[model samples]
Target chain A: MTDPDTDRHNAKMAKKKAARDKIMATKTDEKGLVIVHTGKGKGKSSSAFGMIFRCIAHDMPCAVVQFIKGGMGTGERDLIIKNFSDLCDFHTMGEGFTWETQDKSRDIEMAQAAWAKAKELIADPVNRMVLLDEINIAIRYDYVDVAEVVTFLRDHKPPMTHVVLTGRNAREELIELADLVTEMELVKHPFRSGVKAQAGVEF
Target chain B: MTDPDTDRHNAKMAKKKAARDKIMATKTDEKGLVIVHTGKGKGKSSSAFGMIFRCIAHDMPCAVVQFIKGGMGTGERDLIIKNFSDLCDFHTMGEGFTWETQDKSRDIEMAQAAWAKAKELIADPVNRMVLLDEINIAIRYDYVDVAEVVTFLRDHKPPMTHVVLTGRNAREELIELADLVTEMELVKHPFRSGVKAQAGVEF
Candidate 1:
């Protein structure tokens, strides 16, 4: 008893759904993923943290290693520390941005320490997702060897663990190795107009 | 006495923090923000959801009206429905993608209903953050009038409320009006390689 438009819509949706099912049928592979988020826009790390939140919702274990952003307080870190501490291994190991530190050797040392922790988390099969927050920045600065990182991921990573690397200037090697890579392009930012970062939105 | 490297790092950071503090001092205005997330890459809606999580952490009330993504089960929707129902007003008011539905009149009706709900949320001062999820797509398809949407936002949005719009092909008008805009460019995606969208990652 449906009208012509409703009948037509239903028929069209049925056809589309069938085609989608056929496409879905071919995607049978299940394994870990290497996800990379990079570029000058704001959401690279925020989006990674979003995934961590999603993992938390599903009760999946997660580990986070922040390479160059630990010198100051961030809302996401504080929230994780306060509520989801049991499900998350959160480490903010950096002394701050490289420019702020202004010490190449010290920055390299911190990056190495963070990488050590990242390797440990990746090697452990218990953790479902390991977020290498800002690790790309470290790699971009040559604090961590890109080839070594790739080799470790290929040789040592668990089969079902997801690893997310985020920051600006991600290496070509990492991008090539990643299963998903997103570049957050800066279209417009309030900061350029003298608006400062605010809580509950920026951090 | 600390090591020379440590001392130098501390001095540099002190100077940098001071400069940052100076910049922070000038930022006195606080008001609502119109934020837009657009482009071909993923994480536009995911990043907006991340902010919703942040708001939940801060005990802020939020309202989300999804324009074109409610034909099936999504992990994020389920998670919020299960846990954070008290803090968020969640609405999924679309039949599916435009191609799937293939009915302009029905799509317009759904878009109008969603926009009505969006206006209600945006006008309510109790809602600190109102996310108009995928409204850009609705506007792109001309199911809703862009001018009307912009006028409503400009005239009715509460001063302290934040409104976020997520979807591809954001209108130039919205971009011009937004305080923060991010274009997520796709660098690589596993879907192109036959990897299906898995739960907890894509949803």
Candidate 2:
């Protein structure tokens, strides 16, 4: 009772399913990965935070250390602090952005302290994921040495810890070392049209 | 006890703060945003979910209509169903990918149905945010008319309901209509190196 179109469609789908199965069979290697989110567009930090929420849903321990945002009251940060303090070790270690701080020596000191906490979190086997939010900006400003950060990640990170480093202008060394890297290219932004950042979205 | 560096830093920060305050004074307009996330990389859907999590934190009602993933048991979907069900209305409308479905008529029917649900959510003032997940793919394939979608979005959507569309190869017309658009460019992918997607990250 099947029509000719239905038969053709079924045949095509079966072939595709078979091909996908073949590809899936070949992908068996399993290990923790270094993921990098960068570029001029948005979602670099938001996506990392999404992964953190996923970890929370799965009951996996995770840590987040903000490098440049300081202690500013972001919706994501506040939510985590209020509901997920037990599951997440969240830290805001900077006074503010570089332009606001306007002190190179102090910026470098703050970056070093944040990096120390990040390193400790990466070494902990109990933590399933670690997000070094905005570390790329610190690296770009030369406040934190990218080579040292890369070396520590390579040598000290636990086998099962997925480390996510996010910010614009990620260093080539870190990108080369990462297993996954996505550059969020800016296509269009409303701020150019005089729209300010708003709550529940921008925060 | 104040050193020259501290005094210099203080003066510079004060000037920067004043400049920021001036800029902040001008940004007062508030409205819903048309957000598009597209290109050949990850985090498009993840970041949208992050926004949804932010909405949940704010006790803002949201809706998600997944167009291409079908009824896959993703961790994000499960978490929303289990814990955030009261806050988020989630729907998976597609049978699968086009290749997996291999039925043009059926795909078109499913896309239309999903669009109807999306429109309902967008028009409702109660929904602060509505995610048309993977709608770009449906538009790219012509399964759903892009012009009608854009027209309805412009004319019928509530003023305060932020509409987020996610998928690869977003239509230029949609981009032109969007207030925010991000192109996620793939820098590197673990799947290329034979690493499979893992739980609590890929899901």
Candidate 3:
């Protein structure tokens, strides 16, 4: 026989409980992550930023390492790191993106160190979200070893960590390992029509 | 007869001249301006992030205040803001998106304050970039005064400043004034297909 008081309590819990708690209780959190944002489109990094913004709002520990564009000349990194010093950890490999870098060896080295840093954070289940900006394109150029990256992510700690990889030209192997994957296929671009990259539009 | 050396120089200059440059050169610099992004597709904010990331690399001043998400807790803001603290500004409004806001008065109030902050920064030419993310949607809901925003932009300074607006439902006036505009129209979404919003893909 179903007790009336027990049924009433269950109803209350269903209506008032935190949605996150409900989700966490039902699904086993998968620590494994791989997000490949590829396309001839804009906003690949911005898509990753959306995740970063959301993750931090949730109180999840996170880190960001932009491979090709993490240099001293950028304004976004400066603006972000200065304001939220206590809650976030920001690191740039001090290397610009490949198209801007002429030396292939240096490019590869930057990508390698970036991968290592990402691996270090992933190992610490405390870092829940990791944004690897423009990584797939770097991998495509062999700027870093894709095999090593795949292996590291596959072995990442589960139930407490997540990783977000954003760039164009995502690999099939990486996509296969990703529990969640978003492919941003570009349909149009202003640069194609001869518009220069504005400071806030294309930076 | 014209000098051969002068003729050569004249030819070179003529070859490099652009049809629009003469007019553009005379226009005043855009000290700063706000960009609003909204749409059915993903990556509205990602585009803004690309600019932000690029700005951070350059050591330019920038501030990001994302509304429609907060208090859920995330580490994206926490981690990057740590190392690049001197360069960037990161603030999440923590009140999840407007669709979820359901409170019209609260939404309007949030829009007003956020717009106030963005306008303040944007008016400063030294700020470089001020992305008023999702401003289009806010305007659509009457959360902001669309006419007033257009008037401010119409009287903008150029070159020295730039405003990047990202979002769907860009009003007639906003698009007319935008030096650059991009629309991310949705073809498909994972959320509609029953896949939950992933940490990195859709935070």
Candidate 4:
């Protein structure tokens, strides 16, 4: 005798499979994406690095242009450069965070320099991916002109290069232009409970 | 004569450095964390794997127990097991997603088995980090007991073992127990725009 529960499960799964297949069938387009990772929580930069790692595993060349975060060395930055030096272009262009530099004009200069590097990377067809790490923060602070950045992103980016922008407080125009955007919301943070950031975990 | 911009920038940076130093001095405590990555967006599992990569780079041992995601092979799973076999303990225990399997009892059985493996990993002091990937979906679907999982995480986890749980619709109790919880909010997704999941980006 067949188990009633198993029978029911099989029927349900068959229906679900059909629905999923239908949806999957509708999805067929393929193109490079303008991706944004933003908001008040963690993992924006981490997720970008994850994609970089994925690209590295696939033997695709990638570049990272870090803005507004150059005071300390990060494990990801170090490991990628050390392991995949030929395939990765790692650039830390900012002197430090705004709160750590306090010079608005200097910050603007650094951001512009970083943007120049980002543009160069984006223009290179050889680079499959370019991560503009913390560029949103620089744009948010007016260190880089948002409108100009948006215009370049819309017009100048290579057709096959995926660009990932990560930071808190991403502007409205960028979000509207992005093919994908994820806003990480802080539900709870250990820092609020007095837990300090660890090297491997935070960096 | 000193360039006005350079001189101004130096003085401003010095003051900013002093303020940052003051804030940095107070952060001293260090402990393992119970981190939850949940909600309606991408990057939950990707971020967890990024942490795993960090741990691997630091020569720390890590383990992954995947629930509700075992039908297909992922690049991360394949690469980590192949390259860092000694450092990573990867177990994909679930048969597939709930909709794919559609068997409540079998799903529950798989979840319980996965939990058993997770407990064993957590109990072993050798594993510095344990990622319970997509366990939240199992718990949300009633395949596993959230209360029991919470109790083990709170009372039984090793002092220095960092645990990262990732999935959508994490229970309130689990969030409450987590040291850090990040909710990945979906601002936009390519699937909505009829774009299929790509190999490097999605898996």
Candidate that scores best on DockQ:
2
C-alpha lDDT of candidate 3 relative to the true structure:
0.60
Candidate 3 ranges with C-alpha deviation above 4 Å: A1-32, A46-61, A69-73, A76-117, A142-152, A155-159, A182-203, B1-38, B46-127, B142-151, B156-159, B166-176, B182-203
Model 1 TM-score relative to the real fold: 0.88
TM-score of chain B of each: 0.93, 0.93, 0.72, 0.93
Q: Record all residue pairs in model 4 with backbone atoms less than 3 Å apart, i.e. clashing.
A: none
Better of 1 and 3 by lDDT: 1
Q: What's the C-alpha lDDT at position A186 in model 3?
A: 52
Candidate 2 clashes between residue pairs 3 or more apart in a chain or in different chains? none
Interface RMSD of 3: 9.2
Give the TM-score of candidate 1 (chain A): 0.93
Q: Which digits, one per residue and each the tens of the lDDT, describe model 2 over residues A2-88?
A: 698778877887798889889988999888899999999988988888888888878889999999774223667887888788999
The worst-scoring run of ten residues by lDDT in candidate 3 chain A lies at A70-79
| Model 2: residues with Cα > 4 Å off, grouped in runs | A1-11, A70-73, B1-24, B70-73
DockQ of 3: 0.16
Give residue A32's error in model 1 in angstroms. 1.1
For B1-203, candidate 3 gives per-residue lDDT tens digits of 55675466445545445434554455544334334444455677665666766666676776665544532224345544764556556655526555344444566788788777767666676666665656676677667888888877776533456566655677877766665555554644334334455554454
DockQ order of candidates, top first: 2, 4, 1, 3
- Report, for all candidates in order, the number of backbone clashes: 0, 0, 69, 0
For residue A4, model 3's alpha carbon misses the true position, in angstroms, by: 41
